[model samples]
Target: MALTDDVTSCLIDNNKLFKDIIYTAQYTATSANHLGYNDSSKHNSSSNSSNSSNSKPLPPCFDLKDAYRTQAFATTTVPHDIENPSVKRIQRRLVDKFLLTMRSFISSLLSLPILALLVSVAIYKTTVLHLQSSGDQRHHSMDEKKEALDELLSQDETYYIRRWGYACDTHQVLTPDGYILKMHRIYKKGPPEPSQGAKDTKKKPPVLLGHGLFQCSGAFVLNEEKSLAFMLVDAGYDVWVGNNRSIAGFGHISLSHKDHEYWNWGLKELGVYDFCSMVDHVKVHSQVDKVAYIGHSQGNAQAFVALSLCPEIADSLSCFIALAPAVYAGELVKNFPLSLLIGLNDWFYTLLFGNGCFLPIMSVAQQIIGPKIFCFMAYSMFSYLFNWWDHHWLRRRKAKYFQFTPRPVSVRLISDWISGWGRQGVLLYVQSPPPPPPPQQQQDGYRATSMTTTTVSSMPLPLSAVGSKRKLPLVVFYGTADYLVDGQKFVEKVQTCNPFPMLDLVHVERLEGYEHMDTIWGHDNHITTYPIILDQLSKVSYP
Candidate 1:
């Protein structure tokens, strides 16, 4: 971005005159079906000027050493309707109507579940009112009926902490870039009793758990007593689960929900700023020089970014474990429905709400009413997109899901991934002007010349971590039947990424019966995955 553009954006941000759409996304394809290549023009012209004189050569597959030697973001523009204003307008309007129709339709489909849950509560309430069998039920009968069910579904961080008996503490960690994220910590196992001596009086080595895309720390504990976060506390690791910046309940210290700047961030910031800062905070608080890192789903994406972009912190990591990791977007067209949805992500987003926050209302609704049709719709979409779910496990834990799953995330981030180019071989500007003056500055004239793009010539890896002399321990775990990840292909891509990747040791664990989320939330993760994870962490510590 030009210094002048920075000044102008800062001015706009201060006066709040800017629109929230991702302007840089003009290169975004009309349809998501374009092979996941970012347009070649996305890189800063100046950064790639020398190569501009000669036709650019094709990039190799994602070799960390070869990922982004020059500042370039490669992208391939698909057949979008942006060039025709009239058609674009029609497209967006048509899409908006369709989305509304779909939402209403989904509500109709999911209403059965909602109605069933509501009716059950009503019956329980009526029965208690008449029989007065238990004191707790009698007290409940007196409270307003409508408010009771809403309140039941809307439990917060504190409620879960108390319910499972985990010792809890809260921390507000400020990022270098000035975003203040609220973080939750578990120092001891729950069912807190006077005789509970499980927690070591001395601080244990820190272990940070990052939630999945759109989700908060709640996912780690949705299974209640059997949750991963609670289990970690039992194992004597000081557990910290964080809510990344773009999540529903999260916000930057300076940016308001209303500020366009709040929408400026994508997945990059979630990893580069949010996850990294929280790691620093935990180290200082626990006085532990190294910590174990576990990322579930997209959380793994952020950790990969941390290991790649911030090489200086390599030694700070004792180990990196990814559960249901989604590091590659290779051969996505194979998963036609998911690819199509992602391919048209931008168009649908444009049609639905034109580049601001994605589903902000849904975020609020989930919090206020707890789980409802909207949450059901979101989860159902996932079930269709990735069908390896163990039906039996879900049926057993059915009640916990509605109240716990479906986190709100920015559509911009989701759109980026669907683009394919965004995650696989994305290149970005090497230099950006100093961050615009905070909310206080009024500024003017900046022309951004960076033309970012993405190309998946190789598997994704950080330049530094790819070649690190001090290897970070890495364990990649996945569910065998998960379409979200091409399990076999991922292994092949990793082996081809480098002759020897920087990790001191790498282990790939693929399990049957488990799907994407089961690695972390399965009732038996303690029996299946946790032992491997703990064993890996122990190896790192002992080594």
Candidate 2:
């Protein structure tokens, strides 16, 4: 923002300077014309005609002096004309000056980004040197210091995971729609030995962890041992971390990231294709009929759409754990600037961010600035935008938290999310038909009416419509203080509407003072958040 202000100020000052220069040139020409310099050219022309051999061209100052004398002595004066050679020369000089100024302005404007990059590089180098010096002085081994530096500087999730003494394996799964997403599996660092825990590892149920918007799978593993991924691993669950399309790196089977078609997807596609494909892959890999699923914010939103619309994939989840689920506009978003921005048309949004990935340059900036500076900028931006204080964040590992996130997502995806804020009720991928009326309502010609209702005809009927069918367990952990999305309001709406009977056994826990990000990064979350998740995961009956 400071950089933007500096550039704006520069432009404004240059505009004022250009206006002043134009005014001075105009004033000088007008003064010359008032002194009768326009007639001097004709006066000189006639003289030159009469004494062609004797006459030489008058100096430029001579014309002004001759004009002043004629203006005082003669009875009439000639009007200013653009065709005057003297005036033309002056105009050409003015044009040349203006062009020179513009060239300088353009060069400076172009160099601002380059200057910012150079500064970022300088800071990065200085930080690297400082870390190396600190590492040498510290009691830790060289490998440990290297690991710490790698976690601070690397963009890969596996580096973060392995840095904390956890094993990480990267798996690429192909979605039906041609998007190849990356997933990370976290486990004990060493190979499985003939121990009791190692023997039981194969028997453990697999758990899939999905990150929030603009975040990759690395978000859950940033806090080292305190991170949700490591906690899950410690809790004897096989943890699989999932990424949405275009995150980390754009991996499409046929389309390039530069192509608009590669990014021509929104939340619906994420849920329908990315989430479903990952679940299927996890099931096949784990050799289980069902896998426990956990999602954060927009991750939960995708799960709601996927589990509600696709019965087969819905059945594949042993339990759906939603942390600070973002399915509706919160109080903060429903007001002021956010509401106004969200109300704009899709074309307007596309114009703002272009048709491709959203803010890909931020990733480049992050790499240049290094994690500490990037983390500070990110925190400041989010704090201002979301009115968050981040009091609960694990401050020691805050830089690492930002090292892996703010990944590239489609502009269409962000636009869709923004559009949803303008409406009331659950955010839907496609407009679903109104749910079937209750049996009593059907018999008496009365129907259920609620703003949050959603029903898919292609999927199996709800449990209310078809009594006592197998239902997907949806466990919700919401923060009372989260203003980005009203998780409490959504939970209440679901309970009141009872629209999704497929999610009949919905469990909701409201954390008293937690914020949106606190669900994942809160201090002592392993004790507060993970235990609840672990308790819920324990209830799932694995096949």
Candidate 3:
């Protein structure tokens, strides 16, 4: 009788605990085929004891991770109450409705662009053939021309690097937050002769290049020898290119792309985990005390935010070179449709588009359209969005440029940018409180030692830990005509506002006719911008 009583009490306790967990748990939707609970007929068919009178109803779909469940209680076979089945039925219906609506919306949205691209491709081919027949014929055969075009459309970054007589190595960096990022290291094909009075090949300083929003490391090498990556390699500096986690695909130690939790991050996580891990990896691999960092557009924002949160990593940087810095987007916030979309609050946004990757159909379409057609479509979209014209880019390399960009980004990352736009700052998603007493800092064009001696891994510094006194050399290149971000304003604010203290604004240049992407992809950038960047890098690294 005592054993029976104890068993009853135990079952009651477990049942109550299980109920609490289930009620509080957050549920994510999977397909009806993937989730057994969503398909009652299948579940009923699979059950052996369906006819048994003593058998209890099965629990509603529980999507909680293992961390949420207590081991002892997890094994407890508790059944659902009468109310849960109906609730779950409603949930399943709502999920189905939501997914169907999203799919329909996406399909409708994509149809126009897909149709436009098809037409554009047809016209592009017609024009090429017309040009060939209209006395524009070259000595090369049609097959050769097609072969060259195919190579341009299909080659990856490593292909270009090796083609340009350089060696490229791929390294996988594991972030503290379980993300695995792929990085590229570029060097000359053979052992580089020791520079005059240098120790050996190892003495060559390392420069890390980070790409802009929706771009991968491939952007740095797309322009062949004229690209910044190749230029740096030719200038006798080791070049390493950094990529975000979702560049090629969703890379994580434990989470698959299908998992909702995998997409639950924003620019904050990028700065904290991505930058920290990549910087450390570069520092350790190069066998150097510090690395010179260069970033363009959103790439610049990541570094700035990373420095703000984790001052300790500043020790690993020799200097920072920002190309079209995206710190202050005050003017950009006023742009059409984008302004309207960004104005929506988080809950409403998630309600409208579920919490997943942002505009996944774009990726799907990109894959389906093939590289050549996708490149034409990408150019059209960029031209419309940014008011950029074909004249802004190097004409010959334009197709190659589009082949690499517009990689997958999370909806949360875009939300984080919107949040920052509201604040009119680059400090994404984090409210900036009044900082402590300003540390003794150096002014423009001066170089100082690193701020902190403490080496950190993965963890960001606390807010109280701001105000490092060290001077980190910074060089800025901004386009006067660039409407995407107010780079001039970013320079002004960092110099005057004194946001953390280590930022030493050394040199500032305003390119008169340049636009946002002109810093890297413009025809004259190799002659006009690359030399100046090389000079700054050399000053900090060799000094």
Cα lDDT computed for each candidate against the true fold: 0.52, 0.62, 0.62
Please report the TM-score between candidate 2 and the true structure. Answer: 0.66
Best candidate per TM-score, number?
Answer: 3
- For candidate 2, give the lDDT: 0.62
Cα lDDT tens digits, model 1, 1-543, are: 223333444553443211111121211211211333332333333222222222112221232122221111111011111122221112247787787557544544544464345445544544444356334322223222322132244437657766667667666554433344667888655343353465545445789998876667877776666678887787767899887865534444334545333454455556655776677767766767787889987887777655555555566678888787666543443554555454443333344433445655555665666355544444454455455343324333434564555565655555545443333332231112233333333222212212111211222232343353767777777776565655555454444343224453357676765677778766567667777777776666622
lDDT score for residue 277 of model 1:
68
Q: TM-score of model 3 relative to the true fold?
A: 0.68
lDDT of 1: 0.52
Clash total of candidate 1 = 31
The CA lDDT at 433 in model 1 is 21
| Tens digit of per-residue lDDT, candidate 3, span 106-129 | 644754475466446555654564
Please say which candidate is ahead in TM-score: 2 or 3. Answer: 3
Error of 2 at 379 (Å): 1.2
- Give the root-mean-square deviation of each candidate in angstroms: 17.4, 26.3, 15.8
Off by over 4 Å in 2: 1-151, 191-202, 430-467
